[model samples]
Target: MEVHAHSHTERKKWTHYLWEFLMLFLAVFCGYLAEYQLEHKIERDREKQFIRSLLNDVSTDTVKLNNLINVRNQRENWLDSLTYVMNSQNPRSFPPADVYYYAIFIPRSIPLRFIPNDGTIQQLKSAGGLRLISIIGYDIGVRNLTRIGEVEETLINDYRGIAHYFFDGIVFDSMLDANNIPRRPKYAPQLYSFSDQNLHELNYKLFSIKAYNRASRRESKRLLQQAENLLTILKKEYHLK
Candidate 1:
C-alpha cells in the first residue's frame, strides 16, 4: 500500500474573516443608503409637482377674485343708490324708472357670485394628502371663502323675497333688454306698493345684502392676498417662474 502525504492548506486568520465581514457590512449599508436617497428624491419630486399644480389653480383664482371684486363694487354702488331712493322722505316722488333699474339688480343677479378654483386642492386630498401643501394654508382659505360665497347667495335671494313686497315684477321684467341688461322700458316703470312699511322692510333687506356683499368682497381680497403670498413663497423656495 502506498502512503500519500496529506496536503495542508493555510487556514484564514481571524483578522481576515473580520475584514470580509466588514466589507459585506459596508456593501449592505451602502445599498440601503442608496435606496433611501432614491426614495427621498421621489418624494421631493412629487411634492414639487403638487406645488406647481396648486400654483396654477391659485393664479386662476387671483384673476377671478380681482374681477369679482370689481363686479361687487358695481353691485354695491347700485345697492347704495337703491337704498337712497327708497329711504327718501318721499320714495314715490323719485322716478319709477330709476327705482326699477336698481331693483332688478337685487333679484336674479348671477354675475356677482364667485367660487374658488380648488381643483388641485381636491386632487391632493384624494391623492397623497393635504399634508403635502400644508405649508400654504390655501385649502382653509378656499373653504372659508366658499362658505362666504354660499351665504352671499342666500342673502341675495332673501333680499329678492323681501323686495317683491315693494317692487313690481312686471316693471323689473320689462326693464331688462334682450341681453338681460337693464334698459329703459318703453312704458313707465311702476312698483307693487310704495307704502312706508314695505319700503322700510325692503330697506332692511337691502342693508343685509349689502353687508354680506361687502363681507364677501373683503374675504375675496384677503384670499387673494394669501394666494399671492403663497405664490411668492413657493416661487422663491422652488426657484420657479
Candidate 2:
C-alpha cells in the first residue's frame, strides 16, 4: 500500500496582508503629493504672470510721471517770469499778450487730472489675492500708489481750483487763433479786456499761486523717486528688464 500524504495549501500569513495594506497607503499618499505639487506649480506660474503685468503698469506710470514733472517744471519757470514781470515797476513792458500766453498754456497742463495706469493693480485687488505678488511687494506697491494718488489729488487739484478762480475775467481775444496747437474748450468763458485787467490783484494772487505750484512740484518729485525705487526692486527680484 502506498502511503498517501494529504496535501494542504498554506494560507497567506497576516504579515502579507499588512504588507499589502502598507503598499496601498503609500501609493495613495504619493498620488496626493503629486497632485498637490502640480497645484502649487500652477499657482506659482499664475503669480509670475501677474507680476510681469504689474511691472508693465509700473513702467508706464514712471514714464507718465516723468513727463508730468518736466511739464510742471517748465510751467513753474513761466509762472516765475510772469510774476516777476508783474512785480516789476514797468509791468507794461511785458504786455498782456505775454502774460496771456503763459496763463492759457500753463493751465493746459493741469496737474489735478493725472491718471495713473492702475489697471493691473485694480485687477489684482479684484482677484482677491494680493499675496500672489508676495506679501511685502504687494504692500509696498499699494502703499506707494495710494500715497502718490492722494498727494496728487490733494495738491494738484487744489492748485487747479485756485487757478480757475484766479484766471477768471482775465480773457484772451486770440486764444483760438493764436496757435493750431490745442483746441479751445467748447465752453470757453469770455475773458476781460486788457484795460479791465488789474495788475495789483494779479500780482498779489500770484504769490499764493506760486507757493501752491512749488509745493505740488516737490510732491511730484517725491512720487517719481519712490515709484522708480519700487520698479528697481521689481526688476531685480523678477529678473525683468
Candidate 3:
C-alpha cells in the first residue's frame, strides 16, 4: 500500500510538470504572435501615412499651377483689350506703348521652352501684352537622347544669357534627384543636392515645377494630390484668406 501510494504521488507530480510546461509554451507562442501582429499593423499604418503625405504635396503643386495659369490668362485678356482699343483709335498712330508692353508682358517659359518667337512677341507687345518669357529646364537623359550633365551644361550656358535678357523666372526640370524627390518615405532627404555653382549660374526667382513624365504618372498624381491638401492647410495656417 505504501509503494502504491508513492507511485501514485510520482505520477501526479510528473503530470503537473507536463501541464506547466505546456502552458508556458502556449504563453510564449501567444506573446510572439501578438508581437508580430502589432509590428505588421504599425508597418501598414506607416505606409498609408506616407502615401497620403505624397498625395498632398502633389495636390498643392497642382493648385499653384492653376493659380499661375489664371494669372497669365488675366494678363493676356487685359492686353487684348488694350490692343483692341489702340487699334480702334488708329492702327498706325497706336503709340509705341505696345513695344513696352511686349518688353514686359511675355508668359514665362515651360519646361519645353514654350515661348513666343520675336515676331509673336512683337505682336503681343504691340497689343500691350507683357514680354514674359517662361523659364524652362529640360531633362535630356531619360530617353537616352543626351547625357544629363551635358544637358545641364547646355541649359546653364544657353539660359545664362537668356536669364538676364528674357526670363522672368527659372523653372527647373527634374530639379530634385530621384532620392530627394518626394516619395513614400516620411523623411527621405533630397535625392539630388544642388551645387552652389549650379545655383549661382542659374540664378533667377526660381519656380520649381515638375515636368510631366509618363513613367511617373501614378506617383505624380499622388504627390500632386498631397500638395493640394497641403496648400489648403497652408492657406488657412498663414491666413491667406
Candidate 4:
C-alpha cells in the first residue's frame, strides 16, 4: 500500500488573535452599555409616575387645609363669645339660653382634624424609592403637620376633661335634635352649676383650646404653603403641568 501525504494547515498570527479578542470585548461592552441605558430609562419613568401621584395627594391636602382653616376661625369666634359671657361678675345677667347654648356647643362640637394622603409616599418608602426625590423639605413639612395635629389632639383631650367639670351631658343630649344638630330651646335652659370655681376653670380650658387652635391654624397655613412650593418644584423638575 502507498503512504498518503498529510496537508499542513497555516497557523493564525498573534495580531489576528488579538483582533478577535478585541471584537469580543467590544461586543460585550456595547451590550452592557445598552442594558444600563434601558434600566436608567425605566427608573426615570417610575420616578415621574411617583411625582404625579404625590402632586395629587398634595392638591387634596390644600383643599382640606383651606376648609379646616375656616372651621377653626369660626370655632375661635364661638370660644371668644362664650369666654366673654362667662367672665362677667354676674353670670346670670347674660341670657340663660345664650349661656347654655355656648356651653353645650364647645364640648359637643367635633374637632376639626386632618389626615394626610400618604399612599404614594408610603409605597416609595417601602420600595426604597425615596432616593429618587432630591428634595428633603417636603418630608420635613409633612412631619411638622403631623406634630401639630398631635398637639391639637392632646389639647382637645385636656379640654374635654375640664368641660366635664363645667357642663352637664344631660343638657348636651337635650340640645341635640334627632339628626344631632343643635336647635334653640323653646324654654330657657339652666346650667348644671354657676359655681365661681367651675366657671374660672372652664374659662381657662376655653382659652387653652383657643391657643392650641390658633397654633394649629398657623401650622396648617405653613404646610399649605409648603405643599404649593413642592408642587412647583415637582412641576419644574419633571417638566410636568
Per-model TM-score versus the true fold: 0.86, 0.70, 0.35, 0.83
Which candidate leads the pack in TM-score? 1
Off by over 4 Å in 1: 89-95, 126-136, 174-187
Stretches of candidate 3 off by over 4 Å are 1-9, 12-21, 71-94, 107-241
Candidate 2: regions farther than 4 A off: 1-9, 109-112, 131-173, 177-204
Give one digit per residue, the lDDT tens place, for model 3 in 1-241: 4555343433567888899999999999999999999999997665445434433433444654444445445444544543353335343344334422332332223322212112432333465543222201111111221232234334334444543332222212222246433112222112123344544443331211111121123333343344445545545543443
Q: Is candidate 2 or candidate 3 better by lDDT?
A: 2
**Cα deviation in Å at residue 12, candidate 2?**
2.9
lDDT of 4 by residue, 118-229 (tens): 7887888888777634335666667776787777677667777766564666776787899887766666665555677887777778887788778878888887888788
TM-score of 4: 0.83
The lDDT values for all models are 0.79, 0.62, 0.38, 0.77
Give RMSD to native, each candidate. Answer: 2.6, 5.7, 20.8, 2.9
Instruction: Please state the error at residue 15 of candidate 2 in Å.
Output: 2.8
Among all windows of 10 consecutive residues in model 4, the one with the lowest summed lDDT is: 131-140
Q: 34-129 in candidate 1: lDDT tens per residue?
A: 999999999889878988988888889899889988888988998998999888777778787777877777655467656667887888778856
**Highest lDDT model number:** 1
Tell me the lDDT of model 3 at 48: 46
Of models 1 and 3, which has the larger TM-score?
A: 1
